[model samples]
Target: MIPNVIRRVEFQYCKLHFLLRTRPLSHVMYSGSTGLVTPVADPSLLDCSRAAAQDVDGFAIISNFVSSEEEEQLMVDIRRTLRGRKYLYDHWDGAIEGYSETEKSNWSESNTPVIQRLKAVAAAAVTDKVVVPLEQVHVLDLAEDGHIKPHVDSVKFCGEVICGISLLSDSVMQLQHEEYPDRWIHALLSRFSLYIMRGVIRYKYTHAIPTNENSVFKGERITKQRRVSVISRTQPVHS
Candidate 1:
């Protein structure tokens, strides 16, 4: 049993695992095992659980979010567009986090072709009136052993949803509920795949990429390839 101060409850068994949390706590729940279900007794947990279960009505998955060929071209274009730009910060080797404020100041008025194309792609995804155009976006590149610490995006962003498109390689993205820290949901992000996370899944859970030098999925430790991610969100962005 693992209890999280932030409203996560976790139960783990030899072949199963369970996670639970609330909205104020981060709306994601991850389950790894098959049986032995338990009811959430905490009032805060119950509130979040209810919200998460209810929020699934609008969930969407856009597989083949980007094509490998398009991703390759985009990488080249972004690199060229970003050349000599001072706002690009190295969050990790081969990974840069773009600042929206800075980007707006430096590139928004440029009318660059690549930027225009990107905007078009973003526009297509914002079909719902409630889903506004993402004001901020970030790009991440990961090589072998590269990873991010488990964390939830800051709530101040008012970001009700997060959309991520994979550009290269295939990797696993893990989401864990603070309630059930030991249990997790692993999503394989294939090149060109698009994943949209919202509702409880977006706000209530912590997400991360493990830093194992050689990660074993299923039974093999395949070398990691250079991978890029385009993260789109509505913001008041925060670190």
Candidate 2:
């Protein structure tokens, strides 16, 4: 009869060999010290269909939120407003890089209509409770090479709902689960699109805008350009 230790080792070796043959080398992790081969859990392992089927709560994107003409006009307004302003590379919060940000409590005559429309869209997206847009809106200008790192918004600043309208250029936003790195999804923020994040998406996922080098969506490469976003937040209602 075969010794128990030998039998166990033989079984493990067969299992390892089977896994190495069936799976891609990129999916396997080898430990040099223990001579063990383990399968790595990566988001890429799951196909796009399966990942899209996951019940992601409180995340929605509205494509073509504004007309082409309206988008052009809005871009002009943004450029004029931010012209000649010095951008901050080192922010106190350390949330952004190569970015220029300012707060807009009031919109100009040409820009007020867009702000009102954004508020309306935001109000309709979140149905649980009424979300009042704060007087101050966040205007961010991302440089051509800039990117936002993965991070969750501070609870002290905003409430449950966060609304943002992407303008000027197209890009992809990646939201990864805070607890499980392998669970992630990418949302394409096309020009003039509005994205809403609330509840689980707002609190549980760390959202980021990767650089052009690593930007991808649904297996297609994405080339990022200078983008601008007008972000609005609801008042903080602490329980």
Candidate 3:
């Protein structure tokens, strides 16, 4: 028998080779300059099909959460808002430890720019599908070099349910813990895809995207596309 190490490497290489030849790369997934197993038929709500991918805590990845027309419009709106605005070093500080107070202060005034259509669609998903009310709403715009480090959002300020929609490009977001540093839960945020994090996914596993040049998925190098994410949360709750 081949050594286990060689076996693993050979298996992964074969898998990767098969994927590259059989599936079209999704510019939407890493941005397809490129593609997965069967996705749910309608991802407007949580689908049991992805239950296996969820960690004990809980996480959901919804593909085609928004239509192509909506995505195009959202991109226009996202670019407009992103223009002429000064971006800060980190938008995640408040969601993590120690900076809860500072982050909470901006919450009230921040929802003004989020497009109504986008907000309505997300809220509909939450209320109709997830059966929860919408709460905090904001955007995280990633520059070519921008990415939020691995950090847990503070439960003291943010709510239990967190939902977000990607715009402009595709990027990878990962979840992992210090205890199991070697294991990572990755969500490929394709443009217009919806990602919801709650339960263990929210409180336990820390999530982040590496800085632009450092981005990768499945051991493959990827380009950083300027990403605009509209994120919302419910009232603060115990996670």
Q: Model 2, stretches more than 4 Å misplaced?
A: 1-54
Compare candidates 1 and 3 on lDDT and give the better one.
3
Better candidate by lDDT, 1 or 2: 2
| Residue-level lDDT tens digits of model 2 in 121-154 | 4444455477677788888999878889889999
Candidate 1 wrong stretches, greater than 4 Å: 1-61, 82-129, 212-214, 218-222, 236-239
lDDT for each candidate structure? 0.45, 0.69, 0.52
What is the alpha-carbon lDDT of model 2 when measured against the actual structure? 0.69
RMSD score of candidate 1 (Å) = 15.2
Q: In model 3, how large is the Cα lDDT of residue 129?
A: 32
User: What RMSD does model 3 have?
Assistant: 15.1
State model 3's lDDT. Answer: 0.52
TM-score of 1: 0.55
lDDT of 1 by residue, 1-239 (tens): 11231122112211111222212212222111322323222222112233344443223333454445556666775566555644433453332233211223123222233233233333333233334435545665555446666677777754666666667677666566667544445555556655556655666677666555534454454344666676666544354
lDDT per residue for candidate 3 within 43-87, as digits (tens), equals 222222233344532565556555566566655655555566665
TM-scores of the candidates in the order shown: 0.55, 0.74, 0.60
Off by over 4 Å in 3: 1-57, 79-83, 90-132
